[model samples]
Target: MSTGPVTIAVVAGEASSDLIGADLIRDLQRLNPGCQFVAVGGRHIKATGAELIQDNEVFSVMGLAEVLKDLPRLLKTKKQVVRTILSSKPDLFIGVDSPDLNFSIAKAMKKHGVPVIHYVSPSVWAWRPGRVHKMARFIDGLLTLFPFEVECYSGTGIDARFVGHPLAKQIPLQVDKQRSRAQLGLSDKKILALLPGSRNREIKELTPVFAETVRKLNTSDEWQVVSSNVSEAKQKQVAKLAAEQQLELNFVDDTSALLQAADFALLGSGTVALEALLSKTPMVVAYRISPITWWLVKTFRMMQLPYYSLPNVLAGDFLVPEVMQNDLTTDNLLTACREVINDPQAEQRMMQFHHIHQSLLTAQPDQAARAVLNLAESLC
Candidate 1:
């Protein structure tokens, strides 16, 4: 056994992935004193004592068109990151989400004989199923958040483990709506939580439509609309869009609290939808990518799954209404909200949320960390 500290190279390119990385790093440090991390991530991972090579913002863009626009610079950064990680001579490499960037870097590390683990399986099961074979070529192990994802790696020769979702454990099975509302200074009126998205491009694409939805909803005092506070610049952009629709929205910093207080969540199709589900909040998920990207996806028949939202994907059914692309008009969004609000089966839906939430709870908190270190030791 080695007496010296073991170094782990990591890359977590989004806020959600950063949270996962932070938890994993904390466990690794607790189990192995002097466990060091070199990473690419945001505040959460950096706060865990990882030396960040670059801010996560560089790889934040999504969709084919958006990624292409920043490809040159992203490629430059990736090359630099690859060189830095290789030179670090890490005992192990962990790529947390952001498969677009991490897979390439993981491939490089694998070529150099570094044991590679990919945290958070990409949506290969949902689309581009062929990615499973590609991943088998690089990663020594795969850590998946959802249970169903492990089945996707069967026969791929990758040691895939279902570490359970961190959020499922972090969020209580039952939420106190009134208490969360009191904390956020929210009224008892039907609360509508709007989370356009975290990234600038996502906010820009969705804010206008969201603002219009608010404008239509403003016709009556039945709804009190709120949004989660994002970056100051993005907040200002949202305000500008709302102003164009002659509407103003209240912004709160605690998204989890807001979701708990909300009677209904109107948000983009991403992690926030999962948050809303775990909060036991009814929601209508909406999303719109760039036109070219949408066209390319459609023309090429890239999407293997009918649903896009995390909750829906997890359930393997359309558990919630998904308003998307050209269909994501203000009228449609409003109608979906109304449907969720008036649905007779709302309580049944909450029961389903409970079922899914319970399904994601792992008995051990350190499974991910233990799995990573076990892989590293095996390589030696």
Candidate 2:
């Protein structure tokens, strides 16, 4: 271990990235006890003792319109972050997820002679493939969660590594469904996990559709609906909708346990969908964005792949059904959920998803942590 103190800069703009950043910070501290961390992050990263240079909420806006509205504040925060990095002259910088903010900041850092390592390579393969060229120039190394992302980055000559997903390592290799249910105080009766999403924007866009779908399922007594707790405000919003629809919904903050207790899930298309896959839960994915954003995506044909769910992406087929944007409706979501939940062979097929999860775990022994450390070592 180096005797001298090393300052490392990190930035994780949202909840999922914050979790990954926290894990990386913990592993980095373990690897080099003298290392110091400073960055823009949330509660999890703060728990790891990273000095806050800026609050992550400044850059957490989603959707085109939302981002555009917050552009001025976002730009000011970016300048402050860049100024901090330049003044500190850290040994290395790690940007975990949040490609939009992280990529621009990494570009600035690289120009100032700092080695930048970007975790969670953006979905360039899915949309905006041209970003690979820009990323190759700005980022010293790129760490990816998905195996397929490596090929995309390698093709562009970016120093990229498939670090596997942190969740794959964090979640248990062998899941005991019955034990999980018992731990969550759930019964042997079938359970349906509802991950409306963690962000307020996501909940707003998805809750109505989700509640309607649950109402149509009308299997209130037969299947338990467990809605994830995003925040108190969002909880109230979702609760209001559930109450309005007279739907029985269990809103829980302990999402991990809730997911594990689930027989299957109806998840919004994002990190939660991937988490559900890790829990080996058969799921139907649904998502709806602002109408303008939806139209933009469709007009540009931004989605290169047919499926949105990560499990389906990994399988290279429509293994899980996705109803997105204009296509997402109560009837479609209900139908997909019913098919997946009621199928006699569903449990066995979901085991196949677990196989995919196992394959993703190829980056073992703390791959996310190791990748960040390797990048730090290369810089030294």
Candidate 3:
């Protein structure tokens, strides 16, 4: 092991990964008091006292078309970040999600003999299994959030470990809906929580449709609509959109609290689906990427998974409604929302949600921190 304090360099591309990076940083601080951190991250990661070489906004774009549109800026940012991290020469480099950019950075840093640990395994098991072979060549250790992910790296000679997911620990096994509703000052009127998404592009694509669906669902005054906001900018955009449609929407700053208080969630496909599940809230997942990107994914036969949403993926069964791509219409969303809201087997689905939550509870606050430090010190 090194005689001096270890310096860790980390990069988290978007909001969810930023949360994971922040938690990992807190744990790292607890374990190695003198260690320092540098990163390319968002507000949450920056809050942990890590020196930010770059903001994560440039790397936040999703889909092939979306990335291509921002390619020039992303490439430039990546080059600058890689140069800076190499010059700093940290003891270990941890890439939290954003496999597209982080993988490139890891490859460059590994050439200079830096130990590279990737925090979230890319969706190799879901699609593009070829990536696992390429990952084995550069990543010294792979830290996965899900239990099944470790099996994907079999015989790759990469040190793969399941650290569980931080959200499993952060969100309790049982959430109190009445208490959450009370905290949000909400009345018990069968709330339907709307989560268009965190990104501006998603807000643009999903809000109008979500609002239209809510209008159709609430025609009989059977449901109260609550829109969950991630930031003030996004909240303002959603509020403006709601005004244009002349729709009434209640806004909440806290997503978990809204999810807990909600009777049903109509959300875009992402980490929020998992949040809804952990909160024991029933949901219908929906998404719409650029048309060209969806066409490319189909034309090339790139997608391998039978289901796209995390809840169904984990359960190995179709546990929720997924209205996506061409199927993501206002009518389709309304239909799915009604199906879940009035289903007789809702109790069975809730039990399955609890089972999945228990399975992901393997994480300790310091589990990932201890694993990362052990690998770094081993190479020292």
- Per-residue CA lDDT of model 1 for 94-186, tens digit only, reads 999889989999999999998889999999887889999989999989999998899999999999999988888878899888888988888
Rank all candidate structures by their lDDT, best first, as comma-separated numbers: 3, 1, 2
- Model 1 alpha-carbon miss at residue 340, Å: 0.8
TM-score of 2: 0.93
Candidate 2 lDDT for residue 376: 67
lDDT of 3 at 38: 89
- lDDT tens readout by residue for model 2, 1-380: 25369888999998789888888889878877888988888778988989988777667678877788779988988998899877987878889999889989988888888889999988887777888887878887888888878888766656788887878887787777789888877778888887777677877778778877887786547787777664576678777776676776777776766777788888888788778888878888988778887778889898888876777888888888889887788888888888887778877777877788887776365777677677667665
Residue 82 shift from truth in candidate 2, angstroms: 2.7
Q: Each model's TM-score?
A: 0.95, 0.93, 0.96
Question: Candidate 3: which stretches are off by over 4 Å?
Answer: 1-4
Which pairs of residues collide in candidate 1?
none
Provide the lowest-lDDT 10-residue window in model 2. Answer: 362-371
lDDT of 3 by residue, 1-380 (tens): 34357788999988889889999999888778878888998888899999999988768788999989989989988999999998887888999998998999999989999989999889897879999989988998988888999999999988999988888888888989888899999987888898998887898899999988888789988788898765788898997887677678889888878998999999999889999999999999999999999999999988898789999999998999999989989889989998999999999999999999999876375788888877777664
Best by TM-score, which number?
3
